[model samples]
Target: MKDFELDGWDDEEASTDAATSLTRTAARVEEERQALTEQALAERITAAVNAARPGVDKIPDPVDPAGTGNLTADEQERLDACVAGIELLSTATWVAGKSLDTVATGRLFRKLVHKLEPERCYTTIEEWAEIEHGISRSRCSQLRDGWQIGEVLNARGYKAPEGQVRELVPFFNRHGLKAAVGVYEMVVQAIGADKVTAKRLRETVKLFPGDLALSDEDDVNVIAQSLAGAIEGATPPAPKPSTALPTELKREVDRRSVALADRLDRGRIPRNEVLTHLLAAFADERDSRVFDVVFERMKTSNS
Candidate 1:
């Protein structure tokens, strides 16, 4: 090879060295900030735990796990209040999860464990996620969603029977809590609070009439027909024959039909009738301005 002059090569090397030094400095500063954050979180959790311990300890523990016939009247009342407080704390954690970033949440979680159980040592969040089957950061994210939705429901004056509230979370999250409250009130009015099981609530929500004018009787009839079909040979009026549809389409229709059947506390409705109602609803949606606009846009873009 011919001899070459490496002109300005020393300056290039010096520039590279300066860049590396800046990167190292940035990394060091980030690490220090993270440590400071964790320390602050730990201190906060410690204080809260210390504050809560006294009242929680004073509340009498249930002698019977079934919580029946084991305590005086006053003791039972105290236990109920104590349990309510615990649930509130759980709700607060879930609400906080929504606001905190991942690293901050992990720090908070670790600090909570330390404050709650000072006698035991726990591993890092990563190790815990690995060791526990099906437990991960995503699960924590979902937990936050659940708590936030539950609080929304509670705020709307629709509290009690938490399972029912939970069943409607997907609906509330999708349609908004105010809309959910409307549907919930209608359902409670039609079925009564005593009959409102999760299955019943979910099925009722599925058939929500939207803008269609469906009264309580119309809804109650669907449930009644479902119950009637469940009984052997106890058929309602025969439905008109359905046109042959694609297999996937048939499966979806059948799924909704079965959901109605399963939700009924008492009677059975024909699958064909359920399909008819669904088709009517779909047609109504398809004919609406929103669907027309979307369809026109698609056609225009394709052209």
Candidate 2:
């Protein structure tokens, strides 16, 4: 009887060991599988990020014999250093513009301007940029404004192309960061992110009242939906002689018309008083005619 009991105990022990071994093997396989999956996911994310990055031209080596004529050892070294410094600055500026890294670009501009000032190489960043780097004064201003706009957008977890961000600078300056960010977010939500262009942003921004105050709690989607509805319902006005107004003047009228309509909708201006105010304000015949044309178009759409 004792021998029979020992044989049964041994059989049970062997079965348990086999089960434990199988569990260990299964756990090991699962861990390996999970590791590989995670690695693949990381690789895919890296690839996507790389694909989205803008291409930059490779900087050539200044010291390469193929690119430089024969020179003394010291001359070659000095020339190499000078060329490298210029290339570094130029490359950094180009990358900043492409990557929308405006803050870095602005800082680099300041440093270069200061360095050149004492050496009498250039008196101002604008001069240095134009003469040395071939960047225009307008372009320099755009980059500087981009830095300010970028700060606001980055704080709000948004990214835009430098051109798009530059377009927002005027609105940002007038309405403040919160309002600018709200408009940006609304535009992005309305149009797919990839489809946003400077022209599109400019047009959308013109729809908002310059004085309209937006708070953090404001639902940007509400604005976006309203604008979308207005746009969808709007019909192209029949071209009139007044439509020949200068492009700038026409844009101003469009902005005013939109603002007036928004005010009317929000009850900021009494319905009864709208016409009185509008007529009194439009003393100039040309201004009145343009406003009349634009306002009528706006009224038709809203109605």
Candidate 3:
């Protein structure tokens, strides 16, 4: 009987040890599986972020705070241009409470950076021309796709991502899109101090919504002047004679009366002259005739 009891106890001990070993093995396998899953997820996220190739996410520190600057020669030139633009358009009010030069440099730097890093950026020049500048939509579309034009546009701002510049320029050039770079300077210089001209330009030629959203009349004027300066070399439309002069041609009419209020800060323009040129380009004979009546009245008031 003692022998039988010893054998039975050994069998029971064997069964308990086997069950414990199985549980331990199962726990180890689960841990390995979980580690593999975590590693895979981490790798995918890293790959996605790496693909984005972003620049600095935060606003950069200003180069100066007192409006007096310690910028490099090129940077100083850019600042001077920005300053000239602000002063010329009577937009000095917007230059208040901040370092205009520093702000200008920072913005310019960002533009350069964005142009250099085209993978994550977009160009608005073509869109600006199409929506606001009276450049036909088809022309704008062609410009975007035309290789040389695109090159000129980009080169106006920056060199392409490494050697990519060479290819882009050729493509843009071949497609009849060769652009003279740095036209932004011209834009600021044109239409200086003609505030009313600025507002009309914004209404008629503003291609980008973001640019047009500026509420300050002076600021809008300054920007309009800048754009006009860029394209001052462009062809001006011819004036056409109108047949039927309406009663609104007299001084008392209300429509386009606000046109007379356009100021030097608005983008210093020869208001009637520009209106006439633009009307000739944009309006039908009948519409231009209607414009003549209001224009005659505005001329009388300013006279």
Question: How do all models score by TM-score?
Answer: 0.34, 0.37, 0.22
Score residue 213 of candidate 1 by CA lDDT. 31
Descending-lDDT candidate ranking: 2, 1, 3
Per-model lDDT: 0.59, 0.63, 0.42
Per-residue accuracy of model 3 over 215-294 as CA lDDT, tens digit each = 22333335445445434444544456776447666334323434644643354345366557656755666567656777
Candidate 3, residue 102: the lDDT equals 40
lDDT of candidate 1 over 1-303, digit per residue (tens): 989987667987899999999999999999999999999999999998987664556566655554556777777687787877766654555454454435345564464344335675444554344344344676554554455455554564544355565576776666554444555555666677556677877776656433323223344335334323333233334567977798997787777667777787535567678757655655685467655666798999999
lDDT of 1 at 78: 73
Candidate number that wins on TM-score, 1 or 2: 2
Pick the winner on TM-score between candidates 1 and 3.
Answer: 1
**lDDT assessment of candidate 1:** 0.59
Ranking of models by TM-score: 2, 1, 3
Runs with alpha carbons beyond 4 Å of true place in candidate 1 = 1-58, 62-71, 82-90, 93-97, 100-135, 160-162, 189-197, 209-303
Ten contiguous residues minimizing lDDT sum, candidate 1: 226-235
